[model samples]
Target chain A: MRHILSVTVENEPGVLSRVAGLFSGRGFNIESLNVGPTLDTGVSVMTITTEGDEQIIEQIVKQLRKLITVIKVVDLTDLKSVLREMVLLKVNANDANRAEILRTVDIFRCKVVDVSIDELTIEATGNYEKISAIVGLLTRFGIKEISRSGMVAMKRSIQN
Target chain B: MELTGAQILLECLKREGVEVLFGFPGGAVIDIYNELPNTSLKHVLVRHEQAAIHAADGFARASGKVGCCLVTSGPGATNTVTGIATAYMDSIPVVILTGQVPTPLIGNDAFQEVDIVGITRPCTKHNYLVKDVRELAHVIRQAFYLARSGRPGPVLVDLPKDVMQVKTKFVWPDDVKMRSYNPNCKPHSGQIKKVAQLIRDAERPIIYAGGGVITSKAHESLTWLAKNLHIPVTATLMGLGCFPGDDKLWLGMLGMHGTYAANMAINNADLVLAVGARFDDRVTGKVSTFAPMAKLVHIDIDPTSIQKNVSVHVPLVSDCRLALEALKEELAPSLAEYDFEAGHMPWVTKVGVWGKEHPLNYQASETTIKPQSVVEKIHEITKGEAVICTEVGQHQMWTAQFYRFNEPNCFLSSGGLGTMGYGFPAAIGAQFARPDKMVIDIAGDGSIQMNIQEMATSVCNNLGVKIVILNNGYLGMVRQWQELFYKKNYCSTCMDAQPDFVKLAEAYGAAGFRITDPGDLDRVLRQALDTPGTVIVDVRVEREENVYPMVPAGASLTDMLLV
Candidate 1:
């Protein structure tokens, strides 16, 4: 089972290493991790995606909460949450393939951020499935370069 | 008052009520050392950086206060790594202050510069690197707070040379408010009620305790619960003194080298109430089959320790003392309704039978002294009241087996890390903590030499720490392993050209003695104990003696190799 954990930690030096060390040292595999400053000063929020069984995931969450810098950990997978990832893809698009590429991009609601004489750079932001679908379509036109920001997530507001 | 960073560091320590500091000075901490004479804090200069940490750890364990040490950067900082890791493993609270290169030279590969914070991240509870003088007081305050709070462990504060030189107003915070690091010290009442109900219905209940019990001062509660319910108690190496060793309900130390009765009781238990014990691998050999018939109720302060190794049915994340107190409260109302004698008598009888069947025994020789007998004599001479510390290997096991510890903070050893050279310096620190008590370090020949230089520290401080070296001339534990599992292929385990430990002690301005015959062992030990200052007594023992009732790795606790 895949699990998304939202962790809030003190924005202190070497905290990232401590978090990463806990996962790697314990032999827990991390699929993706995104970290940035939270709204509160001196606090950072990290979203980590990992797959494990019930026991393993329980251990992971408990271990994360054990770190002195980490404030709170929420298993967002069980709750209603929104997750998003952004990817930038530069595809080779000569005259012969430019129209087809633009059509495919339009169908997927992606934007062509930059255009050169021989290539078109497109930006897409969505869930993992949506980003992967756009990347798969762009591969047909020969992707010259690609960069992906790991998934960032949050719990949805309670619905009364 | 305006003060340099070094002066501010001393001021914070004094305000924190630190009376003694164990440390070794070098280049990075020259400024601090220069300012040390002005403060009232007594500093015991150690020979090696590692011993400084270990001594401080011993002081903390014995006194229930955060141990403090200071060392210079680079190799000096790195030397304390093993000691810090040892303290971290046993959750001993210690604050390590290390001097680093100037702030500008931190990452430039300057002379004697190392990233102490980066190196100790995995081992420490928390660590900091102070780049500015203004933050020094705050960081020091936070370091002490984190080191002694909740699940206590070592915290390192790396001070750059320039930071120590900068002048600023020394302002110590009255309190540290770490929002994220609050440890849950109170057990939920509902969970306690559930566990109490389980205990009421349990046919064969066993209380498994660990180091947390000692750290949290829960021995009275643990003993009350066990006696009230008539449950047998088994303890880990770190928990040896947490329960009275002479109690009839005591199943001597449990785990790999645990007593036969303790192992069998754990094996046949129907309900295991694990308190403050993280099911360490040594404790739960073959975890799948461990307590196969038992429903485990684990109570620990560290949440991660609950399911990190072995899963339990009921997990209570709280301080050991608090949890035990709550459990006792929950059990009080239901106590009158339950028939304790009828429920647990049979189980207790069975455990008692196992205890008598294979008691820890060793034959004493007329020519050579047996190490077990030496430890037994020490226990007898001290009336089981001495503060006993040990280095790793067979001597440690013998001391743990033979020494009957009836009080908390009486037996100190490197339990989790099993680091050698831990005992001598630890004995010094323990003596400082309890000046009226007799302190002895039971060491093996191979282990005593690791930090033997600390004999000077003891003599200089006029500390009466006795070191009894069980001279087996081999790394006895490994040799036992090779003899049992590897067909007696003793590979490089011999210490043929070892130094004369007695003379070595005399050279350090301490008394020294050597006892070769069994008859002279007691007399020499008594003499050494009566000596005014530090004394080392080397007793040549039977070379082939091995720790018995051993369980091979991956074997169930029930399976034992008794000799």
Candidate 2:
């Protein structure tokens, strides 16, 4: 099972390595992770997606709590949440296939952030499914380069 | 008051009540060493950086205080990694101070520079690299706090040369609080009540204690609970001294080289109160079959340790002492009504029979001294009062088996990490920790040489630490495995060419004694023990002797190859 661990840690230069070391040290590989600053002055939140059983997940949460800089850890997978990812791709393009590429980007609600004589850099933002779907469809277009911001997550809010 | 970064570091250590520091001098640490004479701290200069860390670890385990050490950068810093990992694995509180090259030269691969913080990140409980002298005091304070606080372990503070040489206003941070690092102390009352209820209802209850009991000072409570409830008690190797070894309810040390009684009791136990101990593979012996009929109630300070290896039914994440006290309170009323003693009598009696029938033993010979006999003699001569340390090998197992520990912090071994060459230096540290007590390192031929250079440190300090080498001329533990599983393909286990330990000790200006005959064992051991200086009594034991009552790695606890 895949678990999305939303971890809040002290915002320090080495905090990322400290948090990431826990996973690697325990022989657990993080499938996808993204970190960003939070509302608090000296804190940052990290969203890590990893595969493990119930025991391993429990162990991971407990181990995370042991870290000195880690403030909190919550399994976002157990809660109602929204996950998003952004990926940019520089794909081969030409006059013959330019319209097709634009249409494909248009259908997926993506944007062409950059363009050149031989390539188009497409910007994409969506959940895992959407990101993978777009990447799968663009494979035929001969991707020149690719960059992805591994999944970021947030708990859903109920309006008052 | 304004002080150099080095002075500030020493100030923090002094405020933390540190009296002794086991360390070695090097170029990177020259600044710190320069400032040492201005302070009251006593430094025990060790030959190797590794021995310094191990000595500090031994001191901490013996004194129940944080052990501190200082070493230089690069190779000096790298030397302590094994010792750091040893302490990390066993959860011993040690504060390691490593000198680093100047901040500017750290990443430049300057002379004698290495990224120690990055290297030790995974092994340490927490670590810091002081970039500024202003933060030096705070980092030192916090490092000590982390090293000694809940679930104690090694914490490293890397001191850059420039940082140590700089000056800063010494502001001792009284409040060493890290918002993210507070360990849960009070276990849930509901969980304690549940554990209490389970204990009251259990017919065959057993208390499996570990080093946590000693770490949390819960031995008294553990003893009270086990005695009042008529539950049999077993300890992990690290937990040897937590419970009185001679107590009738004591089933002896449990796990791989554990006694027949301890293993069988765990197998049949209906309820296992696992306190302060992790169910390591050595202890669990085929996890699927471990405690097959028992409902495990694990109480540990580190919550992760509770359910990491085995499935825990009632997990109380709290200090062992607090949880044990709470459980006693919760079970107070029920204790009067529950016929616990009568209910547990049958099980305890059965365990006693197992102990009696298949007790830990060896074939005695008048020609060659048996290692087990050597341990028994040490226990007999010392009256089980001395602080016992052992290097990792069959001798370690034999010492754990024969020398029954009746007090906490008396038995020191690299239990979790099983690091060889740990005993001798640890004995040096233990002697420093408790100068009044007789500290002895029961060693094997292969392991005694690892940190054999430390004889200089012990001799220089005039620490009367006795190193009793059980010489069989082989890496006994690995050799035992070869004899058992590998068709006797001895491989590199044979330690044929060995130094004359006694002569070597004499060369270091320490007493040396060699006992080759069984008839001369006691006389030689006594002479060596009575020596006024550091002594090495190398006892030539029966060759090819194996530590038995063995449960092959993957075998169930009950599946023991007993002789």
Candidate 3:
């Protein structure tokens, strides 16, 4: 099972290592992690995507709460939330498949951020499935370089 | 008042009621040493940084206060890692202060530089690297608070040389607010009621207590709950002194090296109420088959300690004293009418029968002194009053078996980490903590030599700690394992070429006594105990004698290899 944990912690030095150390020390799997400051300068939030069963996740949450710097841990696995991941991929392109590449990018609603004579850099943002699809189709043109921002998630408000 | 970081550290320590600290001087800590004259704090200059941390640990365990230690960087800080991990494993409250390189030189691999905070992150409950002088006072206060709160563990504060040299206005934070570190100390009323109901319904109930009872000082409540409700009690290696050992309700120690009665009782128990004790692997031989018939209710201060090793039906996260007190109160009214004692008579009788059938025992050897008898003689001499510390190996297990502690904070052994070379220096700390009481370190020949140099520290301070070495000329515990399972290969378990401990003791200006005959055991132990300064009594015992009633690693508690 996959769990997206939203962890709020004190914004201070060594907080990242503490969180990372807990996972590595305890042998818990951490698929992806995103950390940034929050509205309060003294606090930060970390979105961690991890894989574990019900028991391991419970242990992970309890262990994270044990950290003195960690403020709160919310498991957004079951909660309705918005999750996003971005990827910057430069693909090999030439006159022969350039039209074909533009058609695929148009269908996926992605943009060509950079284009050279023999290469085209595509920028795309989506959930796991959508991003995987666009990246998979573009890989046919030979991926020259790639960068990814790991998953960032936020809970949705009850606007309805 | 304007104060240097070094001055503020000492000031906060005194305000926190610290009377003594163990340390060694070094280049990184020169600034603090220079400011030491300004404060009236008592410091014990130790030979090695390891002894400083272990001695501090001994002080904390004996006095139930947070132990403090200071050391220099690099090798000095590294030396304290094993000691810190030992304390961390047993959940002892120890605040360790280490001096680091200057701020600018932290990661540059400067002279005597190391990332101690990074190295100790996994072992420490919490740690701080003071980068600014203004944060020094508050960080010191927080280190003490974190070390002593919740589950209680070792906390390190790394002080850079620049920070210690800088000056700032010191304001003692009266209220230390840590939003992420608040521990839940109250159990839900409904859970207490449920626990009470279980106790009432259980016919063959047992209380499995551990080090938490000692840490939380919940012995009184634990004893009352056991006696008033007619339940048998068993303690872990760390929980030996938490309850009266002679009490009929006591089922002796539990787990791998635990007594036969305790293992059997837990094996057949109907409901096991574990208070302030984690289900350590040693206590539970095979986790899947542990307490085969019991419904477990675990109450511990740390939430993560619950269900970490064993599953429990009822879990309460609160201080051991608070939870036990609540349970006692919850059952108070019902106890006034119902005969709880009468209901558990049969179960207690059954446990008593098991104890008689397969007791913790050994055959009397007239010529060669038995290690178990040596502990028994010590128990007789002390009358269950001396603070007993033991080094790891056979002597440790023997002490745990024979030295029945009647009070809390008396049995200080490295239970969780099982670190060797722990007991002697710890005994030094214990002696300093309780100057009036007789402190004994029941050590092995191999183990005593590990920190035997601390004899100098003991002699210099005139600490009357008796180090009783049960000499068998080999690492008896590992050798026993080789004889039983490894085809008697023995490997490197031999230590026959060690120094003559009596001569070694006299070499350090301490009294020494050696007993080769079994007849002289009592007289020599008594003589050594009577000596004014530190006395090392080395008694030769049977080399091949092994501890029994062990539930071989994966075996269930009921399937013990009893003699």
What's the lDDT for all of these models?
A: 0.92, 0.92, 0.91
The two-chain DockQ for each candidate, comma-separated, is 0.80, 0.90, 0.85
Interface RMSD of 3: 0.7
How many Å off is the CA of A67 in candidate 3? Answer: 0.5
Query: What's the residue-level lDDT of B550 in candidate 3?
Result: 77
Candidate 3's residue-wise lDDT over B97-140, tens digit each? 99999999989999999999999999999999999999888898
Give the higher-lDDT candidate: 1 or 2: 2
Instruction: Give the least accurate 10-residue stretch of model 1 chain B, judged by summed lDDT.
Output: B333-342
Let me know the DockQ for model 1: 0.80
Best by lDDT: 2
Candidate 1 per-residue lDDT over residues A1-160, each given as its tens digit? 9999999999988888999999998899899999999788799999999999998999999889888889999999979889999999999999998999999989988899999999999999998899989999889889999999988998889833
Candidate 3 vs. true structure, TM-score: 0.99
Which 10-residue window in model 3 chain B sums to the lowest lDDT? B554-563
How much does candidate 1 score in TM-score?
Answer: 0.97
**Tens digits of per-residue lDDT for model 3, A7-94:** 9999998999999999999999999999999999999999999999878998999999999999999999888889999999999999
Given candidate 2, what's the lDDT at residue B372? 96
Q: What is the TM-score of chain A in candidate 1?
A: 0.96
Best by DockQ: 2
